[model samples]
Target: MAKVSVDRPVAPSAHPPPSRIGLVGFTTMFVIGTDTFLVAPLLPDLTRSFGVSTEVSGWMVSGYALGYALLALVAGPLSDRRDRRRVLLSGLLAFSAATALCGCATGFWSMVAFRFLAGAAAAFVSPQIWASIPALVPPGRIVRTMGLATAGLSTAQCAGIPLGGWLATVSWRLSFWTVGAVALVVWLVLLRMFPSVPAAPGAAGGLRATPRLYAAILGRRRLALFLLGYFVFQAGNLGSFSFVGTWLTRDFGLSTGSLSAAMVALGAGNVGGSLLTGRVAGRFGPRRALLLGLAVSVALFCALPFAPNLATALVLLSLIVGGVGFMFPVVMTLLQQEAGDARGTVASLANAVMYGGTTVGAALCGLLITGLDGFYGVAGFTVVTLLTSTAVFAASGLFRADPATA
Candidate 1:
């Protein structure tokens, strides 16, 4: 396969310029991120539409994560063995189709099935974008590029819920349809603008080779430790976030409109953090940035239960989300560097670990919330999980600064 160079500026360049590639990646992630987050806000509409209870409708969200987590393990290694462009395009097309099908679902189970399929297809798409960044940009710019991509995802998380809620006022299906259309546009842009990235030299072995490849990647102590830390980190972040609406409504007696407004603050902080992460990581080094963010996040989690009113809780939550935002690109860059030749596989596993963490954290919080303190139990869970993550990072000895770059 011919190599496509990405180092040049966008003046009739043979390779797509880095900026264009970044745009495609950001747009793709924004669509997928929006889809992932939009479901939570639409649960009430879905429950009414399908004639199901809220608890049962909640499966739509869980099912998406479940499918994405399981399939990401498979998609990651498979992309390593093929042209990443092919895997990404194929996944996007399938994801778009599945999302459109979701809008057409006549019952709850059908919606769940389509959501699961959409998530599975999406698992194949995002890891390629993550793995390709190191290949596409100079090392100095890689983290910044990652920050851009992370910002797109973070922005989606910030906007998706409220956007979905507003759209639900019109019709819940409109959000799905809109996402599908946006995905299709992104798919076309990717096909036109994405530079061709060939498979790794030894990566083209068939499905039978997957097990050995994954085993080899997982056997690396640094990679394993980092992944463990990532899982714990996400569990804490998502576990608390998963119940934010419930907490606001139940504890503070905030209405839906007020809750949405509060989430905007949280989302804005996340976007700001993402945009700032590259500079922060560059100055302090990824390890220090990671540690600092983790420390601040833990402090915020501990303080959340004591917030005096709705406004105070929102401010605290924003800061907490911002800390997680700062950590996002730093951890991703570290993981990609550690993965070496198996970056695609490692990227996939990282995503899987995130979803698994969210699932586990949410489940634990659910159990905890049934106690006397309710949301306070969730807050305590966040602190404990974050502390565990910090311990893993410290013990791994991989927390040293990277060599200073220009």
Candidate 2:
């Protein structure tokens, strides 16, 4: 068994403050999340530089999501048996290294290979953050702390890729190198700040967790369907946003600077939505919160194509992105509640499904965007994605108040 210093259990008195722990984890996680969106800005550059078709170039985005999805399934269980700090650090280091490899790539396949590795590294990091929070935070503060963590992720999504976009305008390679450096700095901070905890006995016993866990999760039919529906929703959300920078530049004729500014606006909105989601869920229940959030998202995506100008587009996009803040945390809290004791395993499973949806969306959207270059084409696709996802959730019967709850 691999015992890790960071994974070792500690007495409550020795634990760091929840805010600090969340801050450290958030910083690292933001960097990881940034990696997922980083490829967006560089998509056009990649196509031209590598002399590949747009569809092929999109593998740079889809490949990462696919790799992350596969690894997340495994990383969740491994984190249970190993030190979360070590798992997190290792993932960061790998992400940095792989990103650098992407920066230095001489060919398309080489870039894709490094991207796949980068995604794999990213996969391990998310589970640790989810698993570590409950262990590190007080019960009363967990929701807020998780909200903070979600806020950071939202910032990364809305801000990180734009930074990469701006850097790509300077030199695409510079963007990758810069992010790699940032990841290194976060790794050091995590090492110094976070307390280490040991992996659970189940993970250490070399036990096969996937089949058993899936069986258990599936037995709860409602939970299983909800998770699947959530996966579809996530795929649509990521697919649309992952390449929004590219879309804006191509469709609206916005400069990189303007796009970056718009992204920051989107992040600001996300911060507000994320901050309030926990409160709303606590008061109204996760199901109601989810329904409202998804409805908001559906409306936004529907209106996005019709926005007449850059300013109008930005306003709509910000609300759409910001509104998403409510969906994820609510789902996470529900998953944790549903898991009862096996929180780590459940978190990992839910995350895997979410990213699996992301993978599917990225790849499918990549295909959709090829040869059809206009606002209407992308908008039509996004509307279909949103509507289909919404319909799935509405019909799934997972959004009802659990009778046992109150």
Q: TM-score winner among the candidates? A: 2
Runs of candidate 1 exceeding 4 Å displacement: 1-13, 44-58, 105-108, 255-257, 370-374, 401-406
lDDT of model number 1: 0.77
Per-model TM-score versus the true fold: 0.90, 0.90
Q: How high is the CA lDDT of each candidate model?
A: 0.77, 0.75
Please give the lDDT score at residue 375 for candidate 2. 50
The candidate that wins on lDDT is 1
- Give lDDT: candidate 1, residue 341: 67
Q: Which pairs clash (backbone N, Cα, C closer than 3 Å) in model 2?
A: 6-196, 6-197, 7-197, 7-198, 8-197, 8-198, 80-200
Clashes of 2: 7
lDDT of 2 by residue, 1-406 (tens): 2221123345578767887977986787688877777787667677788999766676788778777888887787677777778888888888889888889989999888888888888888877888788888876677778777777788886678678878877888888999999999888888889778666554433545555655766677667766777787777787767667667877777776666676778777777778788678778778777778877777787788778888888888878877787677877877777665556666777877877887787777777766576555556666676677666666767566654551
